[model samples]
Target: MDDLAVAIGLVLVIEGLLWALAPRMGRRLLEAASETPESSLRLAGTLAVAAGVLIVWIARG
Candidate 1:
Protein backbone atom coordinates (compact mmCIF):
# COMPACT_ATOMS: atom_id res chain seq x y z
CA MET A 1 0.00 0.00 0.00
CA ASP A 2 2.80 2.38 0.89
CA ASP A 3 4.59 1.57 -2.34
CA LEU A 4 1.45 2.19 -4.37
CA ALA A 5 0.93 5.49 -2.60
CA VAL A 6 4.47 6.56 -3.41
CA ALA A 7 4.08 5.61 -7.05
CA ILE A 8 0.85 7.57 -7.34
CA GLY A 9 2.43 10.56 -5.60
CA LEU A 10 5.32 10.52 -8.03
CA VAL A 11 2.94 10.44 -10.97
CA LEU A 12 1.03 13.38 -9.49
CA VAL A 13 4.23 15.38 -9.10
CA ILE A 14 5.34 14.70 -12.66
CA GLU A 15 1.91 15.52 -14.04
CA GLY A 16 1.82 18.73 -12.02
CA LEU A 17 5.17 19.80 -13.42
CA LEU A 18 4.01 19.10 -16.96
CA TRP A 19 0.87 21.12 -16.37
CA ALA A 20 2.87 23.98 -14.91
CA LEU A 21 5.43 24.11 -17.71
CA ALA A 22 3.23 23.19 -20.71
CA PRO A 23 -0.38 23.65 -19.82
CA ARG A 24 -1.45 23.45 -23.47
CA MET A 25 0.35 20.17 -23.94
CA GLY A 26 -1.35 18.80 -20.87
CA ARG A 27 -4.74 19.81 -22.18
CA ARG A 28 -4.00 18.23 -25.54
CA LEU A 29 -2.88 15.05 -23.89
CA LEU A 30 -6.04 14.96 -21.80
CA GLU A 31 -8.15 15.44 -24.89
CA ALA A 32 -6.28 12.79 -26.83
CA ALA A 33 -6.41 10.34 -23.96
CA SER A 34 -10.14 10.88 -23.68
CA GLU A 35 -10.69 10.44 -27.41
CA THR A 36 -8.65 7.27 -27.65
CA PRO A 37 -10.42 4.31 -29.17
CA GLU A 38 -11.94 1.66 -26.94
CA SER A 39 -9.56 -0.98 -28.20
CA SER A 40 -6.58 1.25 -27.57
CA LEU A 41 -7.84 2.05 -24.13
CA ARG A 42 -8.17 -1.64 -23.35
CA LEU A 43 -4.63 -2.25 -24.51
CA ALA A 44 -3.37 0.65 -22.43
CA GLY A 45 -5.23 -0.65 -19.41
CA THR A 46 -3.69 -4.07 -19.85
CA LEU A 47 -0.25 -2.54 -20.07
CA ALA A 48 -0.86 -0.47 -16.96
CA VAL A 49 -1.97 -3.55 -15.05
CA ALA A 50 1.14 -5.41 -16.11
CA ALA A 51 3.38 -2.51 -15.20
CA GLY A 52 1.68 -2.01 -11.84
CA VAL A 53 2.04 -5.67 -11.02
CA LEU A 54 5.72 -5.54 -11.91
CA ILE A 55 6.24 -2.44 -9.76
CA VAL A 56 4.47 -3.98 -6.77
CA TRP A 57 6.44 -7.18 -7.08
CA ILE A 58 9.71 -5.33 -7.35
CA ALA A 59 8.93 -2.98 -4.48
CA ARG A 60 7.64 -5.71 -2.19
CA GLY A 61 10.75 -7.73 -2.74
Candidate 2:
Protein backbone atom coordinates (compact mmCIF):
# COMPACT_ATOMS: atom_id res chain seq x y z
CA MET A 1 0.00 0.00 0.00
CA ASP A 2 1.00 3.62 -0.44
CA ASP A 3 0.99 4.26 3.31
CA LEU A 4 3.37 1.36 3.95
CA ALA A 5 5.71 2.57 1.21
CA VAL A 6 5.78 6.07 2.62
CA ALA A 7 6.42 4.78 6.14
CA ILE A 8 9.29 2.60 4.93
CA GLY A 9 10.78 5.48 2.97
CA LEU A 10 10.60 7.79 5.96
CA VAL A 11 12.21 5.20 8.18
CA LEU A 12 15.04 4.65 5.69
CA VAL A 13 15.69 8.37 5.43
CA ILE A 14 15.78 8.86 9.19
CA GLU A 15 17.98 5.80 9.72
CA GLY A 16 20.34 6.90 6.97
CA LEU A 17 20.74 10.32 8.52
CA LEU A 18 21.45 8.83 11.93
CA TRP A 19 23.96 6.39 10.43
CA ALA A 20 25.78 9.19 8.66
CA LEU A 21 25.83 11.59 11.57
CA ALA A 22 26.72 9.38 14.52
CA PRO A 23 27.68 5.91 13.42
CA ARG A 24 29.03 4.84 16.78
CA MET A 25 26.05 6.06 18.73
CA GLY A 26 23.76 4.42 16.20
CA ARG A 27 25.64 1.13 16.56
CA ARG A 28 25.47 1.41 20.32
CA LEU A 29 21.76 2.06 20.21
CA LEU A 30 21.20 -0.93 17.95
CA GLU A 31 23.30 -3.17 20.18
CA ALA A 32 21.52 -1.89 23.26
CA ALA A 33 18.18 -2.61 21.68
CA SER A 34 19.23 -6.18 20.98
CA GLU A 35 20.64 -6.63 24.47
CA THR A 36 17.67 -5.14 26.29
CA PRO A 37 15.72 -7.53 28.52
CA GLU A 38 12.37 -8.80 27.32
CA SER A 39 10.49 -7.28 30.23
CA SER A 40 11.98 -3.84 29.65
CA LEU A 41 11.37 -4.15 25.96
CA ARG A 42 7.74 -4.97 26.60
CA LEU A 43 7.47 -1.98 28.87
CA ALA A 44 9.00 0.18 26.18
CA GLY A 45 6.52 -1.19 23.67
CA THR A 46 3.62 -0.38 26.00
CA LEU A 47 4.93 3.12 26.56
CA ALA A 48 5.28 3.63 22.82
CA VAL A 49 1.73 2.43 22.26
CA ALA A 50 0.40 4.75 24.97
CA ALA A 51 2.32 7.68 23.51
CA GLY A 52 1.01 6.92 20.04
CA VAL A 53 -2.56 6.77 21.33
CA LEU A 54 -2.12 10.07 23.15
CA ILE A 55 -0.70 11.68 20.02
CA VAL A 56 -3.59 10.45 17.90
CA TRP A 57 -6.15 11.64 20.48
CA ILE A 58 -4.55 15.08 20.66
CA ALA A 59 -4.24 15.36 16.90
CA ARG A 60 -7.86 14.39 16.35
CA GLY A 61 -9.13 16.99 18.78
Candidate 3:
Protein backbone atom coordinates (compact mmCIF):
# COMPACT_ATOMS: atom_id res chain seq x y z
CA MET A 1 0.00 0.00 0.00
CA ASP A 2 1.02 3.64 -0.41
CA ASP A 3 1.30 4.12 3.34
CA LEU A 4 3.69 1.21 3.63
CA ALA A 5 5.91 2.66 0.93
CA VAL A 6 6.01 6.02 2.62
CA ALA A 7 6.77 4.44 5.99
CA ILE A 8 9.65 2.48 4.48
CA GLY A 9 10.98 5.56 2.78
CA LEU A 10 10.87 7.53 6.01
CA VAL A 11 12.77 4.82 7.84
CA LEU A 12 15.40 4.79 5.09
CA VAL A 13 15.72 8.55 5.22
CA ILE A 14 16.23 8.60 8.98
CA GLU A 15 18.79 5.79 8.80
CA GLY A 16 20.56 7.55 5.93
CA LEU A 17 20.75 10.77 7.92
CA LEU A 18 22.33 9.03 10.89
CA TRP A 19 24.99 7.39 8.73
CA ALA A 20 25.64 10.56 6.80
CA LEU A 21 25.88 12.87 9.79
CA ALA A 22 27.56 10.50 12.23
CA PRO A 23 29.36 7.76 10.41
CA ARG A 24 31.68 7.10 13.35
CA MET A 25 28.83 6.87 15.80
CA GLY A 26 26.94 4.63 13.43
CA ARG A 27 29.94 2.33 13.18
CA ARG A 28 30.31 2.30 16.93
CA LEU A 29 26.64 1.45 17.35
CA LEU A 30 26.94 -1.35 14.85
CA GLU A 31 29.94 -2.72 16.71
CA ALA A 32 28.08 -2.53 20.00
CA ALA A 33 25.06 -4.23 18.49
CA SER A 34 27.27 -6.99 17.17
CA GLU A 35 28.64 -7.57 20.65
CA THR A 36 25.24 -7.48 22.33
CA PRO A 37 23.54 -10.65 23.52
CA GLU A 38 20.84 -12.11 21.27
CA SER A 39 18.19 -12.11 24.00
CA SER A 40 18.78 -8.47 24.78
CA LEU A 41 18.65 -7.59 21.10
CA ARG A 42 15.39 -9.49 20.71
CA LEU A 43 13.86 -7.68 23.65
CA ALA A 44 14.95 -4.31 22.30
CA GLY A 45 13.56 -5.11 18.86
CA THR A 46 10.25 -6.27 20.34
CA LEU A 47 10.00 -3.09 22.37
CA ALA A 48 10.72 -0.98 19.30
CA VAL A 49 7.98 -2.79 17.35
CA ALA A 50 5.50 -2.26 20.16
CA ALA A 51 6.39 1.42 20.39
CA GLY A 52 6.12 1.86 16.64
CA VAL A 53 2.72 0.17 16.60
CA LEU A 54 1.50 2.39 19.41
CA ILE A 55 2.68 5.49 17.56
CA VAL A 56 0.94 4.46 14.36
CA TRP A 57 -2.26 3.53 16.18
CA ILE A 58 -2.37 6.89 17.92
CA ALA A 59 -1.55 8.79 14.74
CA ARG A 60 -4.25 6.98 12.76
CA GLY A 61 -6.81 7.48 15.50
Clashing pairs in 2: none
Estimate, for each residue in 1-61, the C-alpha lDDT of model 3 and write its tens digit: 9999999999999999999999999999999999999999999999999999999999999
**TM-score on alpha carbons, each prediction:** 0.67, 0.66, 0.97
Identify the candidate with maximal lDDT.
3
Worst 10 residues of 2 by lDDT: 52-61
9-52: candidate 1 lDDT, tens digit per residue = 99899879998999999899989998999899999999999998
Off by over 4 Å in 2: 1-13
Off by over 4 Å in 1: 1-5
Instruction: Output the number of the TM-score-best candidate.
Output: 3
State model 3's lDDT.
Answer: 0.99
Q: What is the lDDT of residue 2 in candidate 3?
A: 100
Residue-wise C-alpha lDDT for candidate 2, range 1-61, written one tens digit per residue: 9856976898799889999999999999989999999999999999988997797689767
Q: In candidate 3, how many Å is residue 46 off? A: 0.1
TM-score of 1: 0.67
